[model samples]
Target: MSAALDTHGKAHDGHDDHGDHGHHTPTGFMRWVTTTNHKDIGTMYLWFSFAMFLFGGAMAMIIRAELFQPGMQIVTPEFFNSMTTYHGLVMVFGAIMPAFVGFANWQIPMMIGAPDMAFPRMNNWSFWLLPPAAILLVASFLVPGGGAGVGWTMYAPLTTQMGPGMDLTIFAVHILGMSSIMGSINIITTILNLRAPGMTLMKMPLFVWTWLITAYLLVASMPVLAGAVTMTLTDRHFGTSFFNAAGGGDPVLYQHIFWFFGHPEVYIIAIPAFGVVSQVIPAFSRKPLFGYASMVYATSSIAILSFMVWAHHMYVVGMPVAGQLYFMYATMLIAVPTGVKVFNWVATMWKGSLTFETPMLFALGFLFLFTLGGFTGLVLAMTVVDVQLQDTYYVVAHFHYVMVAGALFSAFAGVYFWFPKWTGKMYDETLGKWHFWLSIIFFNVTFFVQHFLGLAGMPRRIPDYALQFTEFNQISSIGAFGFGLSQVFFLYIIIKAIRSGEKAPQLPWDGADTLEWTHLPTPAPYHTFENPPTVK
Candidate 1:
């Protein structure tokens, strides 16, 4: 991951080149609204994702509050279902996916030695599409019959019978899909065509490699999702029977298509996270990443295998013995490449000059918890085990471990790792560390107990539970509130860093050797590589 750059023909700062017509950056609110600069757009993506994170987190708090006791306390069961559905939808599409795209917008060009995204104008449009989609999603709650409660998967017959809000939800999903496809196109084009002279594909950073594979996954699978929803829309109104059982369509067909996309969608979120951890672990360990070529191969392997394992989610949906066996073994096959990634990260840190900076701490946290998530996933991959725990809180605990600990924690690590480059200042290290500990502790408290709850035969997505489940639910709820507050503290740390932190030097991390750290200035110039740096 660490490569030296030839300093010959060094690129000039963007602000330094005015030519005949001086550059005129837009002022006030319009600066953000109209800007084509990658940094400006990335900032907007980050803030937007954080906003959605809060919205989703608030929904989670309500859920926990109601589940704090054994009976219904606040929301009606229908509304409770809506909260779960919307929270999952908002966090996955609105928060996690966009957050990585934000990182891509900010980092990919600079890391690969390109001046900007391949299509800057399209980049602007990609971001602008998100708000309308988000509005549609949020507004669904206010409509007659409230939001669709068919779960985040928005499964069949139930979705067809849903009210006007399902229409809104479907349309919102369409818009979000459009936005992702455009962003993926931009990333793929930029990475493939825009590398500096002499920087080959093999020479790209692990983060770049991870995203390159991820973008391919997005381009392929997002359309499948779009198709699934479109079919659902047609069944709802246009007399199509794509998923309508009464109209001669098999509802199970919807599960086939949805999980085909859904399983890869899991990787689509996770692969980029793997990329971030790959970068963080190597840098803080003060070692060049162990087995860079192997990591690339492993990532590609995961993407290829992701398509083969979708049926594991549908084991209890009733397939043949042969079908179940194939899906089970194929699903377990994913663990091999995933295990390679985990091993490489640990090997990268083994007996090296180590540091526990906030970024490193979070990366370490991701390593432990994400592996735990993978183990749980393995447990779920068995046909018999999944039949027993299919819709239980165990399933909930497994994925939250994967999504929250895996993706969200990695995003935190990336932000802290690059905060100096973005802000041109140092955040208070103590406060940042405090934020991390609170998050990891509260995070474990919240989700770990759910595994036991699932094992004890408690089902998920219900507002009420049997009396025996009350104590763990209370513990989980208390931890949920703490986790939510810890994020609030994180927002404070970021604001304080932007406003009053100490000035940063050109290179903050001694071991960070990418173009952004090695060739670019602190608070990287708005434009870079007007003349691409030569890689020796």
Candidate 2:
């Protein structure tokens, strides 16, 4: 964004009127292919993320399709296992993670009043890493034994026992890890150094603050995941027995290390959702975000608590009672800060002039359903409770709520909230409401029943089921199908909005106080602030 204007009052782009950017005349698809503009890159990242969501959602559709009946009537058990593994990896890495990066790329520059990300060339390189990594991941299915069937967790002994597909999966992880590390470092440096003159740490927008935290978390935890995979690779090829009990290595240790990374890795996928909600609720509620300082504290609190609770995920695998109790309480402590966040959202809208536009509908959906997910999480956090609930469909149900209903829903909320700004066109309001209601309703239907299926003693990772789960599974499958179908409408809404929808004005929502709304345009151009625009 522009520094304070000169006495003559022209926006400074760090260039003369006749400079390169001044006359650059933005045009070309090749510009997108080679451009390093933050807006362009951010848009690319968002679309790619959505594409991966569909790609992986297709797998979820398959899994639900197969489970529609009592037996493995569709794919083989091995292939079913591959679907789970590939779907998890692809969604976590390829979808949710990239979408957050997309948000950061799109917003962080403007939020801090900078014209572009700190290291533009490096931004290009980080994005380029994605395709090769995606190719390797997709290639694993064509390998002899099919893809990695060990599930996305890829716990050691099973992973080590796997075949060629494991090798490809490992390579894919390696490349993806490198990409993430590069992206994290770039984000940190950009946020640290790229802000405009007036913005300070506390003055910076909530989105920037959350991203700074997320970048640090990525740097700290992702390498641990890479190491865990490395050991798995070595055990498979070099004869190391890190996970082989017979060879004097403990498989459980791998779980400890993997989850050391895995658990926080989940938050790595989520903290941005926290940031997105923080942005949307205030914009639509026509109020300042309630407890802004408290929101920042709660985010940090959740990050710190995230590290401690990684062990909670390991509780069912068995730990000493003392350790288990400590983890149980520590895990429960997370609920406090999270509760603060949810309350802040509700309070932001408590007595305000709220409108149930598409964005608010999504934000509201997140508030109710994500809390339900959080409640289920707290239930599983108890030491005794987890023992009974662990590894069953209950755990699966809980996470899907948190991730799918919580994180992914928030993502859609963000997209709808920001679509006008990004597209310069208004979405079909009636159609958007339809997408939101059906998606939220069907999502709960799909996942809520799975909890009982787990409590009813259905184990996960099974291709076949006994008769007791028949009815709930049938309902869950139908819900999943409906949820999947809902997105087709979402895509239609977006396309129709872009092609022939109503128009959106700058400062689309009066309460959108962020610099992004004031300083940028609907369908913001290929480049913004090639010279700074004053934030005023």
Most lDDT-accurate candidate = 1
Highest TM-score scorer: 1
Off by over 4 Å in 1: 1-14, 18-23
**What are the per-residue Cα lDDT tens digits for candidate 2 across 1-536?**
01101200122233234345544533355555676777667777887788888899899999998888888799999999999998999999999998889888878887787878888878877787887888998999997888989989998789988879999999888888888888888889888987777677887778788899999899999999999999998988999988889999999999999998988887887788888888888988899899999989998888887887778887877678999989989988989999999999889998888888888888888888889889999999988888888889999999998898778988898888777776667788899899999998899889999999998889888888998888898899999999988987787787777667777787677878887787766545545655565543
Count of clashes, each model: 0, 4
Question: How do the residues 211-258 of candidate 1 rate in per-residue lDDT, one tens digit apiece?
Answer: 999999999999999999999999989999998777799999999999
What lDDT is reached at residue 50 by model 2? 81
TM-score of 2: 0.94
